[model samples]
Target: MSGIYIHVPFCLSKCYYCAFYSMPSLKRKDEYLESLRQEMVARKDYLHGMPVSTVYFGGGTPSLLTPEELKTILNLLHDHFPVEADAELTLEANPDTLSLEYLEALNAMGFNRLSIGIQSFFDDDLRYLGRRHDSRHARQCIDWARSAGFDNLSLDLIYGLPTSTADQWNRNLDLFFATGAPHLSAYALTLEPNSILTKRIAMGKAQPVEETAAVRDYGILCQRAAKEGFVHYEISNFCRPGFRSKHNSSYWFQTPYLGLGPAAHSFDGKERRWNAETLDGIRSEYEALTPENAYNEYVMLRLRTMWGLDLKYIRREMGDAFADHCERQAAPLVAQGRLSRTREFLYLTDPQMLFADGIAAALFY
Candidate 1:
């Protein structure tokens, strides 16, 4: 099954660590939405009648869109695409922008999933990250979403902030688990180049992230998630059974998908395309996947998930020689406890998951 992604590039305020394309003002909201609709209509045939399994509204704060604006876009999608009856439609929201009434309206408009950006539940941490929502707002938003009948809720948390301590990080996780959210996406804080946080660190105005502390926090997250019966599905994502983000899984499994709006990316199984990070409309850059590129991506993406790499499928799709080479390369790593293999799949061991990208790179053809 394929998927569709819509990027909303307007935010009330910019986070210090964010690198995604977005503006703090909604000056061009109408024009951007119109262009998004046009882009969808123009790219309707891109998926070639494949039933769209998921529709994800990601962004610079999707909750900022009014109900009418959101509904208009959803209606356009329904009219133009073959969206599945039970498609996993998701919207990324910020706690500060969501209201009980607004969330209920979103539910009525066919959004079955809500991923809220609650980076931290501590006021200090929130301020340090330059997030608009305070701890109380975050908790209230979750309670309101539950009241609004959103069962498939996901919460995003960022750990390893410069001022965060181990106890504080644990408290954050405890609070997160108490919310009863079925899905969680936790990421370690990293300063992106040219971002406010990075600039501050360079100027010695803010402390840089400590690698040891970040690693410890990641370990804590994995252990807590396992104890809580959440599957560490992706390196950075944990979910209750049957609650994985299907749209995100499509990308990892190399399924074809189309992305609309600014700074969105799409993959067509063999080629990859992405729009420029500009509100000037959907100008895109495309690349035809080479054999090496496909092989590297196949290993890289699958290795990052719990599903692991399917050796049999790889052999059939990529060739027996390539599959054999992978197994041969993995033999040593498996012995070193960095990787483990079942009868037909190979995956990174829990302790070595932090090195997944490097491990995948080492096994690249």
Candidate 2:
């Protein structure tokens, strides 16, 4: 149930909406790779020899790494950790970088899952987002992945673009489902501070995102995904049965995980830790999870998914007073149809998912 997350911080160019730490040039690739290996060796015992159930290489673009470099890293992990024989190893990829040959090699190297960042299958949206690949390239990449024998594939899509219309979003979803990928991670386009999109909006060069439009699009997505028989397992993720992301689910269930590389966070049941955002400060930042903090996170994380919170478990683990507080807070939401409860669990209604964070915060002790 535990996981490992490796953050690869290199990309060919910056996307307009990206706020993640990444360097544009691979001029320092060797240095970074060496540093990554060193970090892995140093943190080898962090999991206490727990059998890693999942290994996720998320990035700037993990596919940018050569097969040999990837092999070396995986070899190091195998050498140092008790990685499960059938671990769900995933690599986040950009379409432009994936070829049949490269994908075949990746499959041979133990990457069973591919999370391709397509963003949108529209050329206009791709250009607006500053993505390197076009619509055709994305389709070709999926074809190549299937040809290379990858069945557990995930596609990343961004909806709620300022110029996105309902028809356009539907077309995106239609094309996405046609690809037969088992998992989809659709996200709303947010204007994060200091991002290129945010700056453009500030300069009056780009229109600000319409909150109402985004909500409407989210509704469209939910309805469409349900019709397609995809499970809305998490607020932003839809997957076919038995295809939920094991690594991400570990986070929701509060299983211990060790995160490697800059800007990565980790939890070990009681304490939470994170590495610094910059390579120069790759050391750890530690915080002990107090009873209050843990209770807040337990509710927050559980509320983000379809699994919801187990009230009985909370009463047993977090005490009856906390459980009673939750019931009192939830009674109004349930009455208003924003929340729903069964004998054992409570969860947000689909429409209320957009307000999950706020609702969780409001219910916090």
Candidate 3:
């Protein structure tokens, strides 16, 4: 029910669409790893000794770490934290960075899950995303992972690329499903400010994202995933039965989790704390959780997932009056086909989930 997340904030190169806190230099790897060790010691009590069921090594590309370096970090976590025996330990891998040997080392170190970043099967789309791996490496990495005995595998794919046609996207999905990857985290590309893609769009060098096209592609993806027997458990995640991500499902279920390293966020069913953007600054802001902080966090995070806001949880955490106010405000949207409710839970319907943020804000207490 509880989780630990470690953000490995180093990448070989920056992707054009990436806005996450990451540095493309390995110059400070030793220093950063030492700092992370110190962070583990400093924030050991953040989860209050909850048995950590999940430990995710998310990017800037966790596979970039050498096996020895990764072992040191994992050893430190096991030494300091209450990581469960069957923890779903996940490492985000870039296709070019994973090899049979590296994956074997990872398996030996108890990393059971691999979320491989293979954004597209097409070489052109890979180039557009500024990905380091070619399409061949992407295909090869999945085979190597299976050969290394990784069953809990997920592949991250992207659609709605300016260079992608409907046929091309379908072909990409065809190849992806053919690999027998049990889980898929496919996303529609977004152009955000300060990203190279955004800058290119602003300067007329790249075509603007066709919103209609993106939505159409999303619908197509959802339909195809359903036909392939993958559950659309979360907005962007699809998985074969029993293959849903435990860590992400914990987030939606409002379970407690601690996030380590730079730009990671933590929640403990109440309060939320996020590490700083820069590595040094992350160390400095390790201990700042308050009661009022928890309430605002419950609202923001709970509203982001398919679970939405449960009045019972709000009444128990907040107050009955606040819960009533939320429901009263949500009534209009529910009637307008943007929201849906059972007697126990209130949430956005499938069509309305695309506007979840705006709907949540409209009914915010």
Candidate 4:
């Protein structure tokens, strides 16, 4: 299914580990809105007349946008794109910005999913992450969303702090499951080179994330999620039956999607493009993928999900040479007990999923 992604690039504050582009103030909201509309009009055909099944409003705290502002963008999308009648509309929210009235307005405007960032249900953890919301606000955010008639809820959590303990991570999971939210997107804290968190480490002001801590937390996440009856559909995502994020699935499934706003990315069957701000104005940069690049991506993305890599599809679409290469590459891992396979598919073993990226890289064309 085709999808549309809108990056709301305004945030009240920048988190230490965040690398996504965002303005720390909303002073340019009007300019951003206008530019976003221009982008929608210019790239309306990116999906090639496909019916859009999902629309996701992500980052710099999309919840910062007023409901009226969000409605305007959604209306424009419907006017220019063939939005499906039952499209899954999702918005990423910071718990500090949600209220009963605000959530009710969002629900009224057809936002069926709310992805709230409630990273950890501990005040100390929130402080360490530089989150503005306390555990109390997070609890209140969930209550308000439910009171406003939202049932398709997703919560974001981060584990693998440099100082993380098993008890702390377990507490976070316990609190999360108690909320009864249908979806959880849990990630190990990653400190990119340019991120503030990494910079702090370079300057000796902060400690970097520990690999041992991350591995331990990920194991806990997988085991607990399984016992909780949540499916591990993606590397960092878990959901109750029928609660997967369709918009996000479009990325791994290699479906076409149009991305709007500065720093957003768009992909068609053959090309991938993204926007950036320049001295002149926002402009696009893109590359036409080579066969090898496409093949590498196909392997990388497919293995991130529980569905694994389809050998049949590889043989049918990418030819026998590529399929043979896959077979040769997978043989060792399969024997090592890191991967298991059927005649038609190959998958990572549960204990080895955190090594998925490294494994995918090894299979690259």
Taking all chains together, the TM-score of candidate 3 against the true structure is: 0.93
What's each prediction's TM-score? 0.97, 0.98, 0.93, 0.97
Candidate 4, TM-score vs. the true structure? Answer: 0.97
List the global CA lDDT of all models.
Answer: 0.91, 0.90, 0.84, 0.90
lDDT tens digits by residue: candidate 2, 212-303: 88798899999999999999988899999989999999999998999888888988888999988777746889999988888899999999
Once all C-alphas are superposed, what RMSD does model 3 give against the true structure? 2.2
Give me the runs in candidate 3 sitting further than 4 Å from their true place: 281-306
- The number of clashing residue pairs in each candidate reads 0, 0, 0, 0
Model 3 lDDT tens row, 210-287: 877677778778789889998877778889998889998887676888888888888866566788888664543434
Instruction: Candidate 1: give the clashing pairs.
Output: none
| Candidate with better TM-score, 3 vs 4 | 4
Q: Model 2 segments beyond 4 Å from truth?
A: none
